[model samples]
Target: MSADEHITQRNSSVSGNDTKGSTEYQTGGIHDFKTQPNESCSFTTLKSNTDEEAAIPLMVGDVHLAEAQELWSTVRDKAVKLRMDRSGLGSQPPMTVHQMFMATVQKFGEYPALRVKKDRTWVTLTYNEYYQHSRAAAKSFMKLGLERFHSVGILGFNSPEWFIADVGCILAGGLSTGIYTTNSPEACQYVADDCKANVLVVENNKQLTKILQVRDQLSYLKAIVQYKGELEQKLANVYTWAEFMKLGENVPDAKLDALINSQSANECCTLIYTSGTTGSPKGVMLSHDNITWTASAAGHMIKLKMAEEEVVSYLPLSHVAAQINDMWISMRIAGVTSFAEPDALKGSLGNTLREVRPTRFLGVPRVWEKMQEAMKAVGKNSSVMKRIISDWAKVIGLQASYNTMNGVSSAPWGFTLANILVFNNVRKALGLDRCRACYTGAAPITKDTLEYFMSLYIPIFELYGMSESTGPHTMSWAEGHRIMSCGKVLNGCKTKIDKPDADGNGEICFWGRHVFMGYLNMPEKTENALDADAWLHSGDLGKHDKDDFLFITGRIKELIITAGGENVPPIPIENALKEKVSIISNVMLVGDKKKFLSMLVTLKCNADDNGDPTDDLTPQVVEFCQQCGVVASKVSEVINKKEPAIYKAIQEGIDHVNAKATSNVQRVQKWTILPQDFSISGGELGPTMKLKRPVVNKMYQEEINKFYSE
Candidate 1:
């Protein structure tokens, strides 16, 4: 038999186990999967070359018999309609998320799909079990009176329950919406009411309490399910996760299957609400095809191998990048996804990464910066001999990385020795030893962070997209990536720079099946986003290089026009300042309608137990202060004392950046360092760590006015 056939034969009988009573399966603990490690395992592609034969089983539960099909006929047909070029990807039928899950489980039934750490032991859920559980959850959702096109709002961190609830809602013909964990009770109510949510899935009592506070205001909410904690107080229509899973026992599988079969690839199945940094959050409607096609396209572009990719899930799934990278792409390629702890952002992420040793990782810019800071702190305390060796290795590693990025085959002298001595150890410490592709997106990453990682032989590629475009539109791969550019557009997607200036910068527009089905219930806003021809105007300024690599310049809404009528993009100058001054954590430029530009800067500091930025300086920042001959351990001390050494160092760095400014309007005339760093809890950053410009402006209006007065 062929390799594919061997995989099919192994998994053909796996779904039979689900015929057992629901309680029997539900009662099984973590030990059940552990005992039957090899039971009904598989890894295979489809066998069919024709669309008709393959799609015949796209109905309920017949995914097992279809065998792994080889042809992309259905995909090709859909591609033609979307006007997408269909050269690669062979032949395959378009699939709903449910159909895709079923088909994948049929081939990889016993493969470890979701792994979560409980206490000290690792719990595994095979692909088949994942499907069966999601199906059960779908029935429960139907039992809870979920109406077609209504929403199921999930509020939580990344976990197995979060993933299952999202998929289950889609399978039950309801919109799956993710609400940020940091959202207040009012924000939670707005999302629930706006989507007309029939069900809300909370991670714990913390999230559950938010729903309960506004439950009276939610007209369409029928039930609330808390996945993580016990009920301290009895409330009607609220159930524990275990109790909720059993509610669907009486609901037949055939009924749920019919709903799944009714789903069309072209219709919206998911809702992504924007961060609403400027205004109220608007839901961006994403079709079944948008998720499946974009996942497949992105995976293909990055050359993700089937059943080989492994990733850590920590970023907020409410954001499109995390949803696409951690959930959808894993489903597409049958990759293993391990959930990180709730405190992953605070510091525990490193421990989880070391344990999981994922093959692919995606992080926002802040995550990368944190890693950079941690490593620098360690290096600062290292022995003199080790530091010397590390410095030499880094020089060699950086040269090798630059050469590879430029498509040069030649490596510098002692490159192999350097990797063996320092580069490899550094990667292994960061738990990136197995990571083949590391991605950074959701915000602009500094060149300093990029080059810092590159010196250690890890190239962090950039991804560019928005919720309206269904995650990633342009991707930078390891082989052909530029440091600052967001890389080339994905295959089957077209990018247009609408009305370029003399510098070739313009509003970036997108055209693809990945373009969303317009903002939910907001035609005016939808019309503003999607033009008449269905092209998505991103409202971001960018330009393509001669090699066609896209570089984002700035957001049109964020452009600062000075009193002299000069247009200035704050990002370049902001990035320059941060790069020049290593101690600066965040920077915001202020000069709109003013004579000259000024800035609000924040120092690097530690976060408190509540995730709020504290006055205490971080280790790296403390070391920098010592280097500058200043004795200070707190941001308040440095600012209050106006420490001459620290101030002199910052001023010197500012002068260096000013010397390189392109125009007088772009130069910083004055700047003030804030006492605390910007953070999510402080209301200065969005969920994905994108700066909330208007909020920051208002918070520091006094300081900003002082700059102009002086």
Candidate 2:
């Protein structure tokens, strides 16, 4: 989050273990993408990824292409100015996000743009291929009445077509409304209607089903374009992705090029929906200028404008963070952006990583935590292995940080050997072996998990932001990344703790150019979140340090005040228990309006890698019963009935969970270790991994009973 997060690139005359002019340290550590194998170097043919990105709005200009270019120049200048200030290094004059994308298309055209593995090979799109795809798709959308600033519905996972669809929509001068891929039929119906979309670019059969269910409800829907080939189930007004491409193929190239020429940088680009934590989601309208402002704040402190730099796009695009960073940010600079291949998440996660070898990656805490859990699972059985891994992790992290800061790769030869032998496995597991830098946001992440990863020589920066505030507000670590806090305030973004509690924490309020114009229809909600001064009250509680380091404490709405006047911020404790205990997955801190705060802990599903023979978790439950001195009968009773077991589990897990707690704040006086974990496919966790507290609390009224009786 630091404006000065300048990672030094490795220059010649430096080995993986050489220092700067002296033997002490280099100016900074370098990301060794230079040493990674080319896309073709992999065992199979390079191909495209299947993970669908949230739709990007395409543009078509019947007027003012030249003016758009000027706007691009203005925004580009802003980006360059901020980028230079942050890195303390100069950058080539920055282009508008649009101008940047044009440059990137030319540089890495031959490299894999997005890819997926199938049958034994990688299916991918190089930059040239992606450009062709987008242009053709744009032409097709043009045939469907595409015009500047018209809205379209986009529902899918992260993929090249998603990008292509977005670009096509934009190239044809249309805005896109991105809906969550997992949204239910009703929610999907709600979003499509809310956006007033005329066309919907869908991913596959599942997405099509949701639309099909409410096809009649969407009176404005004129066309449905399927990006994933033909649909297995027929639906009204549906067009296959290939047929649409062919429609664009015959369209005059001069006409298509002319459309591209007319784009305006200030045009309304995308209607991004923020996932509602307390209320129904609202559309956050972002323009080329709005997006340009958001990305420019980081400038090149996070990444310099490098044409050949590869970025992997995997996070939910509906959200502003990933949409701006992965698609808009990368395209603005014309860097090679790859999507994870395969609809299957776990499969694509590992394989796509090795193939893409991206220079920048952005993800939420859940994704990062999963990577950490994966590493711990690989080494948990051996204490000696864990210790060595931990020590080497811290050293390599600092070494990488120091070397990166100094612009050197001077890891001691001894350290490099250990890294290769011990740390590489961990890095490879997270598919981060080729990563340059990463940051987790959308929620607060634990210092322990982050610090654990930092040791692996991967510089994972923690950032805090919101959908309302354009995205990032404050970033921690002026120099060395802070594991405990989101970084200091971004350049040009003013942040202050509006009010503090006894602990010096308050809701973080942010005022910036990146802040929203207002909610589309919900003026009251908009007014509450945005103040008179235009600072977006994040609705998140956090505290700041004397040095101005901002540590996000918890969500203001989620704090549970007990009868005794103790306020429990659930997320920190829930985050603390995540993966620390193999049995627990989703945890909710309850006990509000009660004598003391307690917890309701949910167990994770221990599925096999292939999920062929699903893991039978009875033994683990039995062991938990033994560990906590709770009877297996009581555990079984509470497990089956979500309501019935809360009290016993709360009381029992609390006693046992305490042995692991470091302080009174974390110690659970009572808790119910649930029968099962909140699943990804399940709606228990919002897409962002923040708990749906009200839903969970409602589902287990009886289980919370055990603590009340005592």
As a whole number from 0 to 100, the lDDT of residue 606 in candidate 1 is 91
> Candidate 2 lDDT, tens digit per residue, 1-710?
12223223221111111111111000122212122211111111111122222122112111111222111111211111121111111111212334435545765567666665456676777778877788788788777776555667889887777888887776666676788887888888888877777789888887887888899998768889888856786656688877667876668878877766655444456777766645687877555445665665454335334455677777777777877777766664546666665443454576667666776677777677767666655564568876776676667666665565345756644666767666677667666776667778876676666667666766678877777666776653326345576777765445657667677777777644455545556667766776543446787877776666777878767888767776677776776555355455567888888876677866544544542212244345445656666454333454665433334554444565567665565567766656556654556676666678777777788888777986
Query: What value of lDDT does candidate 2 attain over all alpha carbons?
Result: 0.60
lDDT of 1 at 208: 90
- RMSD, one per candidate, in order: 11.2, 11.6
Compared with the true structure, model 1 gives a TM-score of: 0.89
- For candidate 2, give the lDDT of residue 481: 48
